[model samples]
Each structure stands twice: as structure tokens, then as C-alpha cells.
Target: MSAVLDIGSHKVVCLIGQQDSNMGVRIIGSGFGVSAGLKGGVVVDMDAAEVGIRTAVEKAERQAGMAIQSVSVNVSTRSLRSQQMEVHTEFASGEVADRDLTRVIESSLSELAQPEDAILHAIPLNFSVDGEDGIRDPRGMFGSKLGVDMHFVLAGIGPLRNLAHCVERCHLRIKSAHVSPYAAGLSVLTDDEKDLGVTVIDLGGGITTSAIFRDNRMVHVDAIPLGGQSITNDVARGLSTPMEAAERIKTIYGSALHGADDDYVNIPCPPMGAQDTLHHHPKSLLTSIVRSRTEEIFELLRDRMTDAGLDVYAGRRIVLTGGGAHLTGVREIAEQVFNKRVRIGRPNGVLGLPETIDGPDFAVATGILKAQFMDIDEAISGPPDLSGRRYRQRRYSGGPVGRSLQWLRDNF
Candidate 1:
């Protein structure tokens, strides 16, 4: 069995499951808790974050009827950045081999020189032999030179260490950590969407993150500091209501688009401090507030994509996930801003999810579970090793070669 924990700005979720004989995941246990001590997906208070993690993990353990000592966690931060580059090497034997593949990947890692940044994922998108490009695997092929296009996701070392310390304080060992948007894409994206090109936006409470996938690999990752929490704050200030009441009202009646009958619908709001006084406002006012903030988010995202030259890679499809995707008319607003086909994506391919939690909000958690069985090139941890033995071992254990060998032994 395997376990994954998704700690977001708004909530913490834990899922325990196992891979079945048919290669599908069957979820056996799940639990969640209200998140605190985290803002913008980074740990702010160690004690508070540890409490939340322990609560969620204990619930999952109770349901699964087993204690877990380690878990795969999700990481999300505004400081996360994406970089794409190409690296090349000449094969010593005039033919591509496993060592050549390892050498090229290591060279890509060496290109990064930021001391404050930590590498989260190093993905080899495609390879080239001599002058020809778009090769998936160059091993055993005759080529004097091997080249690779690599994508990397990086985050601030300070934030990552803080998060890891918090999790450790809860007495849980870290099995692995995955970026938020990357994990969401793994859970919600279709094979065709990934192959053709697609953008996945995870709209969370305190941060909004996105990942671009093409040719069955993630190409870019980016995040903004604003999210659904910002919208709730706007509602609270505009309506003179408490934060809890504003959040409740937003969840119950928020819409990103105005309706003709909105003016006829009235919503009652109690003053921030007064318990008996009530003010009645038209729904149109609420709609206006929500729509403004939601539009700003999409507009910022569009500009970022254009500035990074990633607009072309986004293709014509966009998938929206996370808690913010639940707001009414969010899909329509995304379509308007990006001028692309948009859909609200929910977690798919996993069994035994409760209806109450089976929504786009849970995409990150579900994706973390799915990633456990994927290829090594899909996600790699950093800190270069000179011997290259670690990279070779990991490739053989989790890469295509390992799976093929296992299949052969089982069938033969």
C-alpha cells in the first residue's frame, strides 16, 4: 500500500491506497482537516501545521486500520519557477547507451547554479541523435551525439525546508514531495490532452498554480499569489461581514457571472460585530464582486503565459481544478480570458472515493497517489551525484526498462 498527503492553504487531505493487479488504484482510506498555519502554500507556524498534519494522517490510519510511518506530500509555493533547456553529449561508443542517457540528464542538472533554489522535478521531454530531434529514448541506437530537451521545476530552499521540518515534527517520514500543479495534472488530465498539449490551473485558497503538459510530459509550472481566499477577503470587506460569514456566503451563492435576475434576489448579511442587525443587499452586488476578482485572476494568468512564451504550448484546451473551480461560471470566465475550450476537472481513475470529497478540489491529493507508479522521468529529485550510480539505479527501478523486465518475468 501507498499513502499521499496533500497540504494546501485551505485544507489537508490524506489518501491510502494500493495498486491492483489490473494496474488500477483502489483507495482504501481517506481523511481531511481544516488547514491552518499555512499561507500561500508555505508553512508559517510550525506547531499549527504539525497539528493539522497529525489530525489528517491519524484519521486515514484509523480508516485503513494500519499505522503509516511515511507519506508522499504535495508542495506548492509562489516562488516556484519553470525552466526549459537543451543539453547534448557525444557518445563514447558511437552508440546511445544507458550511461549516455544518464550523462545527458546529469549535464542538464549541472546547468542550474542557483544556490537558494532546490530542484523539484527534472523531466526529459525528448531526445535527439546527431541533428535529428524528438526522440523518446536513444538507448541502443547508433548515434555519435545525443541531445535532450529537459524541463525543470524549482522552488525556494527555505520554504521547502520549513515544510519538511513541519511534517517531520508530526513524526512522519517524508517518502517524496511533488509540486501541486504537476500532481493535479496527473490526476485530472486525459492521455490525449497530455499528448496533444493542455494547461492545468489549480485554483486553491491562498495560491493559484498552473502546469503545462505536452507530448505526455510536463513542460512548465508557475504560480500567482492570489487565489480564492483573496475573493473571500474582498467579499468580507465589501459587505462589512466577518470572515467566516463571508466564506459561507461565497460558497453558497458566489457566481463569476451576473444574471438578469440577480438584482431581484436579495441576500441578508449580519454586520461584522453586531449579532442582531442585518443588512439586505442585492445578489447582483455579490456577483459583481466575485466576477471582478475572478476576472483579475484569469487576466493575470493570461499575461503570465504570454510573457513566458508558453501561450503557444497551452494549445486550445484548459482544465481548471482545485476548490476555486467549484464557483459557478468559473469555466465560462476562463474560456473568455484564454479564448480556449475550458472544463472543470475532477479526480479520475481512482476507486472508492466518497461522493462528498470527489471533486476538483481533491485533484492534487489523488494525483500524488497516481504518481507513485509512474516512470522516473515523470518526476526526479535533485542534488547532483558525481558517481552517477544513484541515477542509474533509479532509472532501472522505476523507468520503462524496469517495468518491461518485470512484465517479461511475470509472463514468461
Candidate 2:
């Protein structure tokens, strides 16, 4: 059995799953709770975060009738970003071998200069032989020089350590950490979409993140510390309502696009201090607030892609996921802002998921569970210790090396 924890700004989710004979994950248990002590996907208060994590995990354990010792968690902080690295080496024996592959990747790691940040994922984009590019695997192939293009997802070490410490307080070890956007893409994107190029925008509660996938691998990832929570705050301040009531109103009647009848619809909002007093506001006002904030998010995301020089790579397709994706007219807004085809993406490839939790909001958690069953060859943990002699000796001992090689052959 494997477990995944999706610690978000608005909720904490725990899922326990087991792999079936067909190599698919079946969710046997799942639970979630309102999040506390988190902002923009980073843990701010240890005590409050621990309580939320523990409550979610305990509920899952009760449902699964089993306890867990470790879990793979998702990260979506604003510090999350991606970088590219390339390294090349000559083969002494004129033939590329497993050791040669390892050596090239290790060299790339050594070349990284992010002292304040740690790697969350090291995805091998493609390999090359001699002067030729786009070679997937060079093993057993004759080449005077072998090259590798690597894409690394990185995050601030300080925030990661804080997140890990908060999870540790619940007596659970973090088996691995995955970028929330990448995980969401893994669950929601189709094979053709990935191969043809697509952008996944995770519209989370407190953070909006994007992941660009092409050639069946993530090419870039970025996050901005703004999301659905900002819209809720806008409603609260605009209507003089409490936070709870504002959130309820937003969920029940929020729309990113104005409707012809919105002016006729009236929403009753309880004031902050007195629940007895109600303020009736036209739904048009609420829709205007939501539409303004929603447009800003997509505009910012478009500028981010352009600034990163990845706008061209993003293609004309976009997939929206996470809790904020549930907002009405969000897809249309994204399409208008990005000038791309937009679709609401939901979690797929998992079995036995409850209907209530089987939505785009659960994409990250479901992807985390699916990642354990994937055959891809990439490191999801922190930076590897290539300087260790033990690691060098056992790097290719298990099925991972074979699976990775096969994946490269099949995909690239």
C-alpha cells in the first residue's frame, strides 16, 4: 500500500491506495479537512498545520483500517520554479553504458548552483549522441560524445524544511515531495496532449501554478502566490461580510462571467459582527468581483509564460485543475486571456475514488498516488548525494534503471 498527502492552503487531504494487478492505483481510503496555518501552500504555523495533517491522516487510517508510516506530499509554494541543465561527456569505450548515463546526470547535478534551493524533481528530457540531438537512450550505441538535457524543479530549502517538519510532527516521514502542478498534470493530462504540448494551470486556493509538458515530460513549472482565496477576500471586503459567509456565497453563487439575469438575482450576506442583520446584494456585483480577479490571474499567468520564454512551448492548449477550477465561467475566462483551448481537468486513472472527492481539486493527491505506480525514471526526492560511494555502487541495482531505459526508448 502507498499513501499520499496533499497539503493545500484550503484543505489537507490524505489518500491510501494499493496497486492492483494491472498496475493501477485503487484508492481504498481517503479523507480531507479544512486547512489551517498555511498560506500560498507553505506551512506558517506548525501546531495548526500538524493538527490538520493528523486529523486527515487519522480519518484515512480509520477508513482503510490500517496505519501508515510515511507519505508522499505535494508542494506548491511561490518559490517553486524550473531550470534547465545540459551536460556532455565522451565515452572512452566508444559505447554508451549505464555508468556513462549516470555519470552525465551526476555532472549535470554538480553544475547546478542553487545553494538556497533544493531539487524536487530531476526529469531527463532527452539524450544525444555525438553531434546528433534528440536521442532518447544511447545505451549500447556507439558515440564519441553523449549529452543529456535535464529539467529540474526546485523550491526554497527553508520552506521545504518547514513543510517537512510540520509533517514530521504528525509522526509520519515524508517519503517524497512532488510539485503540485506536475502531479496535477500527471493525473489530468492525456498522452496525446502531453506529446503534442500542453500547459496545465492548477487554480489552487492560495497559489496558482503552471506546468508545461511536451515530449511526455514536464519542461517548465512556475507558481504565483495568488488564487481563489484572493477572490474570496475581495467578496468579503466588498460586501462587508465575514470570511466564512463570503466563502459560502462565492461557492454557491460566484461566476466569472456576467449573466443577463445576474442583476435580478439577490444574494443575502450576513454581516461580520451580526448574523441577524442581512445585506442583500445583486448577483451582478458578485460576478463583477469574481470576473476581475479571475482575469488578473490568467493575465499574470500569460505574462509569466512570456517572461520565461515558454509561451511558444505552451502551444494552444491549456488544462485547468485544482479547487478554483470549479468556479463557473473559469474555462471561458482562461480561453479569453490566453487565446488557447481550455478545458477543466479532473483526476483520472485511479479507481474506487468517491464521487464527492473525484474532481479537479483532488488531482494532485491522485497524481501523487499514480506517480508511485509509474515506470518513469526520475528522482522525486531532494538532491541526490552523488558524492557518496554507496550511491554510485547501487544506483542501477534495481528495476528502476531498466524501467527508465525502456521509458526513454518508448517515449523519446
lDDT of 1 by residue, 1-412 (tens): 9898999888899999988778588888898877888999999988888888888899999999998888898888999999888988765445677777876787677666356777778888889999899899888788778899988887887888888888789888778888899999999999999989999999999999999998888988999999999999999998888898999999999999999999999988878775568887888989999999999999999999999998988789999999999999999999999999999999998888889778999999999998886655743553222233444454345568776675354334
TM-score of each: 0.91, 0.91
Choose the strongest candidate by lDDT: 2
Worst 10 residues of 1 by lDDT: 382-391
lDDT of each: 0.86, 0.87
Error of 1 at 177 (Å): 1.2
List candidate 2 stretches off by more than 4 Å: 379-412
lDDT, model 1, position 56: 89
Q: Over the full model, what C-alpha lDDT does candidate 2 score relative to the true structure?
A: 0.87
